[model samples]
Target: MPPGPERFVGRERELRELRADIDTPSLDALRGRPAATCRVLLVAGRPGSGRTALALRLAREQAARYPEGLLYAALTDPQGEPRAAREVAAQLLRGLGREADDDPEAALREALRERRVLLVLDDAASGEQVAPLLPHGETALVVATSRGPLAGVADVRPCTLGGLQSAACVELLAQAIGSTRVTCDPRAAETLAERCGGSPAALRLMAGWLADRPGMSVTDAVRVLPDDDATPLERAFGVVAAQLPGPAARLMRMLVLAPGALVDAHLASALAGCALEAARDALEDFARYGLLRRDPGPGAGTEPAAYRVAGWAVPLLRDALEAGERAEEVRLARARMLERTVRLVRACAASAAAPDEAATDEVPLALRFADREAASGWLRRRLPELLGAARIAVADGELDTLARRLASAAVLALDAHGQAAPERYELHGLLLEVAERRGPDRERAAALINLGDLDAAAGRTKDAVARYRAALDAARAGRDAFTLGRALEALGDSHLELGDRERAADWYGRALAQRGERGELADAARLHTRLALLHTDDGRRDAALREWRAAAAAYRRLRDHAGYAATLAEVALAQEVSGAAEESLRTGQEALRWARQADDARLQRVVLLGMARVLERLGDTEGARLQREAADGLAGPGDARDS
Candidate 1:
């Protein structure tokens, strides 16, 4: 079982009842029946009612009894879409060390038939998804958690979880905020818990808020927690939000526009158009109020923490955003957010292309970082928020240019980080929608090309080809060589992935020519490298060498020592493969020298290993051994190779 909260303080009675139900055999099983055998326990609750947490805790406590194995699966994706039953079954099969057959459900059921396994199905959407995954044997136990009761399923024991008891709520608060704080004013603590409707989620948030303010007493908390006629959770969130300072309150409302679960101070600063320090302070303030929860920053050192609005607080904050005067504030905040996000994402792209030791002047002073690593870290941490801001920007209609730039920069950052999940495809679709609606042909072409790239990455070559063709048309309409070259190249790559080598070569040639005509040396160099790989795949060694040499020269001209070194390494490998061992040795040596200049240990290692193999081919056993040792030494601990 995964770890539960550090301080679990409630649900003893529910836990006892659950244990009793698990130990008690079903009436049908008692009659020695095989048809209605397996024991199924359904734990149902609302979104933030700690349903998953309690389920996990029970699983951990009872794990020892099930000797076969413990299997778990989330029946829904993070976006709350119901995950396909086949996918969930596949997960279970993998857990059981078995490959899923055509019918994953059947496979999983069969695997668990004779085993006393504990299977946990979390966040189940409907009975259909749960029914097929249930264990068929009497020995096995299945725990299915859902927001509502699985009324459609037969012969299942149901356990409905509600808010914590008052005592439990107070205990949870004390556990989170500290005993001294709660014990200092026991009556006030109980009042706070009862006012929060004894909901563990609400209590936890309130406790976290109080924890952040060491000087704040329980009485002070109760005094500030306003009275409201709304739902208990909503009223509790309102009371917390009402007590926050003006800037912090405004920031909380703006956070409703943030996409996804987490945001960093940089994003907050952008959204609020405030100083980074002020943005961070506001976030900390919200954390103190339990309106937000903090997570460790992306990288090491003193990086600002990431935060998410408390689950219960989100709807309330969103309500504030859409209601009355706050609506206009949301509009301006989103615009500022889009502007700042675009600039930061652009900086991320620039840093990835040419990592530098110092921040560039082009980056806003507030957004600048110490180096490329810091910039990239910021981008990685904030990609979801950036994508979210892009969606909001597109929806706003007037920020079309900002939306286009944000989409372009975000796509670049995603590519740089090699993130090719469903979210990337979704973002590209959003970008395409915005581009087609309000952007120029160039932006539309870029969006289309990005979509093509995503399709290619997912191995949908035909779809990618279609998108690239559409992109080419848009690029032609715009008469932009950069966009045209990219579309042509993507078309070539998609066809190549589909194994149409002839068409791939033809498209590559056109793109190369277009880039050359437009003096896009970097792009041309990249195309040359692609062509080189294509030729090599077709056993055209001499052609590959020619392309590699062209690529190396372009990198050298641009003073990109890293790219030059990498291209040189490829050139040397081609030389060795073509029986030019002596030339390969010298080229490999030159590659290593450039790798050193670029301070790329990974590149240096590659060059050394290549040289070692070439030396072995040249019958210099001692030289080969020396190079191998040097390469191995570079692989020692603390090398920290780039991804």
Candidate 2:
């Protein structure tokens, strides 16, 4: 496996005794290969009896004996559906960094023929699923976990995992809540663990409940967790659900319908149409009963709030929601949550805008952020939940408008922060689908350009050109000059990458014309720099110089001191690259002065270093030495280059 829990509680004696059945000595481990299998240690038990947990612990304990690698595969998907044997085999093969399109199982067996590897097949639905997965090598070990004995399989050594020891159960509780609470009354703690039937899951649920109520005694738990001679594993979840407060109990029902695994106080609040504190209290109640696990999310590090639906609790919550909640109630809850998500996503994007742009974007005072940095952090932190919400909205028939709005806001925020290319590619595709189906032709054009940029970044120049072409159509239909410029610029870049220099130049000229009409000085300056780079890299020295002058003129007119300084540094680098030492020195000096005025440390360092190189080339050794000292004093941890 992927390493099991860092802290394993209980089952010490079980692990010690099971080693006799599972562990093989060094000499005996190298015996001739079996006809079809190696030693199979099947750990079997009831679902909530800690079967998988015990198997994980046992398999991990043998790490030294099988150092080749530990390959694990869950025979069942997360939805409790059985996975095909071949699929599981393919996953195992991939884990070993080997693959066979024709036959993964055979390829896997060959790969592990003489290797001492640990193969963990978890949650085997039947003997048929387990049979095909077994390695036919004597040196390999198969540690399979199942809810019951694997029928029709012979000569398999078995280990039965069950309830925790009473002492271990108490220790588990103490670990979850605290020793002080358990130590306050050891007798009551023992009773509480005993009442939980020593079932680890039950003990954990009971522990979470007590942890929520610090003042409540373990005796109170012993009483509340009922002991009617029925198995706690079978009854604890329902009993806890029944015992929660009315709103919390209802919230528990609604939680089952959540689109994603994660939930925050804000999402929970909207789901129930309740106050934030009320939703938080409900989440606390659900978490206390193990219906939801406290997972690290957006709030975990920054806000101290978040929970994920516990996998085991899904079916139970679904049953409860079916029995107690109405369809309309669930629908309205989803609507409330979706609308809230749209508003929040829009505000998050707006929060990162400059004051001039933000004036036109009015957000609620409660949702607005102080500045771009804060908004960027919020976007990074909440991106997962936002994605989840977007998925739900896109799928909901009644939420198309909200979904389209969310897609627009989220895509821009992701672009602003320079998030992952793959993720942006996926989200941009979704935005395109939503925008096309939902109206607003301009957004469709924007989405096409956004996705085209991703495709270009991944070296899919032809695909990017295709998208840019489609974007040109959409932009023309919508009369959006800004998006039109973007499409034209992307086409130019893609064509350049494909070595169609003449076509690239034509697109660049068209894009510059569009940018001029659009009246975005920043855009014009950026385009000038792009053309400068293309000319410089193509050895068109005079054309590159003209483009750099245009970029500088645009930056100066815009009063962008930092932009002007950065542009001059680029010019200095270009001059040095073309062997104009005197021009490079003069340009570097101008760059340093502007950088000082803009207080741009990064640009200052770049210019200083550029000047140092020019001085060295001119044989002015002392001047170069002084420039080197100045550059060294401005050095930072990761400022390796101008970028």
Candidate 3:
């Protein structure tokens, strides 16, 4: 019987516990109970820990107890969705004698009562999800392998699995390559086993990998293991990547750059820089040969399975991603990934909703669940990768679309993670050189504009003004209206910082007129808000109020709450300056509400402080003190500049 297939790596304790549970008569009676009863056995372990191997071994070894048949199914939910319970039940029933058209759950329960089968559910995701398909019948046995705890099943025997012992790991490697070769260099074999953390899937992957590479010593393979202790799977991945063909090697690198390890044929083709047919063939070959793990994509319907380098292979995969490719290519690939990553981060950074894709070239990775916590977590984990890409792009003098896009991504990423001040001010400095080199005109202007904005935020008014002038000249030479508008607004803001209200108003007016003529409502709204502030500084309260109202209207049309609240706050300031005490109180209250609604605590504090000054001027000492206290409370702990 081939010993029902070697359980092949480790978890002796888990096997013993499972054996004990199976032998227990009370548990057996529950499983064998009349219709409407079921027993579920969950085998939980990390990826590559041999959960599936163990489950299969246990199921086959106990086959004599299940005289009816052995039924197996893989539950791979489509991307962006959970697998349908009904669909899983239907597949289970069809594996037996039931028809596909029959009510799945009902038919499943019926079939379970009819036979004593060994059911193996492979790659199960969770407990609640797999529990429904459990069978009732004394002679039947159910084995499920998953990444997490399964819930709510009677007489449940939970088997927690782990990697192999050193000896088993070495034996696995020996069986994979040659026992004599591995045994000859026990030290090298021990190193490989330790590097793989005794993971059977890892061991198997390494076996296949080493089998192909005659020149590579087991010690050489261990050297490339990912440095992170928590990700042993990736260390094994690095070993596998060093063994792939050119196309497969490139494919592995590109796949790691993808978000969530998911990619379709279209994306895979783009990544490989090849035709879809070739990409599909390569993907199939990879899966067939076990170089990659395949799972059906979310909402894939009947589409081909999406592939990822096995978890054990991630380290190898990332090493491949970082290796061989010229520094320039690696930088560009990272730039692309960050372009997508930053878009996602920016979308989540907002206190309100995401913007439309058509309005901007950068679009966010939309979340079906709208989970802020999850989005934030993804950004934090990938921060190093994104930062490395930005640094690489700036270092390589290849300032093309890729470089510019990378700079934008870097800026947004910094902002999203709240690292805009001192931590990322250096990024702005790096981008300046790339922009200056990449541009004959438009690129130069855009880069200068961004540099000016960064400088202004850092309180370098003089440097900001200089960069804005350079941007303005480049914008005029290139005849780029948007660039010119941005430069004009930036220059105007710099002037305002120097208390040059007249110059600020003039620049803001020009920007407002140009953006208005261009029908760029969003840009026009921003310019109008700046003009409102300049007018207020110039003591023209009525003009400031008018500009703010118009700005707010424009921002509202564009669904830009950040811009709207800023303009509204200016209007409140105008009311206060014009000595309209009652109106100032009402407008200030409204402005504060809008600022909070916009989810910008920094802007909210600024507005509250302004309101405090207004209340003091109007002789409401109590109200003034309360507003000041509230603003101070909000400004607690963090850098006052971060918000």
Output the number of the lDDT-best candidate: 1
Q: Residues 17-102, candidate 2, lDDT per residue (tens digit)? A: 66886655333345553445767778887666776667778777898899998877777653467877876776676566553344
Please give, for residues 1-643, the per-residue lDDT of candidate 1 as tens digits.
Answer: 3345555768888788888999786777677766454788888988667776688788878988988887777776534568788867866675565655567898888888878888888889898898888878678888888988786677777889888888888788877778998888999998987777777666766776687677999887777666676666776676666666777767777786666546667778877777878988787766655556554344111334676655456667767767624556667777887776677677666666554543466666545555667766565545545666777788888787788778777877767755443456667788789878866898778878888887776677899899999999999999977788888988888888888998999999999999888888899899999999999999999999999999999999999999999999999999999999999999999999999999998889889999989988989999988988888778848653321
lDDT of every model, 2 decimals: 0.77, 0.75, 0.65
The order by descending lDDT is 1, 2, 3
C-alpha RMSD for every candidate: 10.3, 10.2, 19.1
Ranking by TM-score: 1, 2, 3
Tell me the TM-score of each prediction against the true structure.
Answer: 0.61, 0.58, 0.42
Q: Write the per-residue lDDT of candidate 3 for residues 1-643, one digit (tens) a residue.
A: 1122222555677888888877566554546645344445778888668776677778877888888887766554322234556667765654463443335676686677757787877667666666677665555677777777766666667887666789888877777677777866789899878877877766666676676666766766566665576556665655566657788778767765544454545446656676667777777655533445554222121224456444434545565666767767765655555444444435545412344423233332222213434434444433433444565455556534554565566566556545433325445565666656655788778777877876786678999999899999989999998799888888787888898878888988988888999999988887777777667767777888898899989987987777777777777777777778678778778778878888888888888888888788878999888887788778857636222
Q: Which stretches of candidate 2 lie over 4 Å from their true place?
A: 1-10, 17-47, 51-245, 297-303, 339-383, 408-421, 516-643
| Model 3: residues with Cα > 4 Å off, grouped in runs | 1-7, 10-13, 27-36, 76-81, 242-245, 252-643
Q: Judged by lDDT against the true structure, how good is candidate 2?
A: 0.75
Prediction-by-prediction clash tally: 1, 0, 12
Candidate number with greatest TM-score: 1
Reference-based TM-score, model 2: 0.58
Off by over 4 Å in 1: 1-7, 16-43, 52-145, 150-158, 173-195, 204-229, 296-304, 343-385, 418-423, 481-643
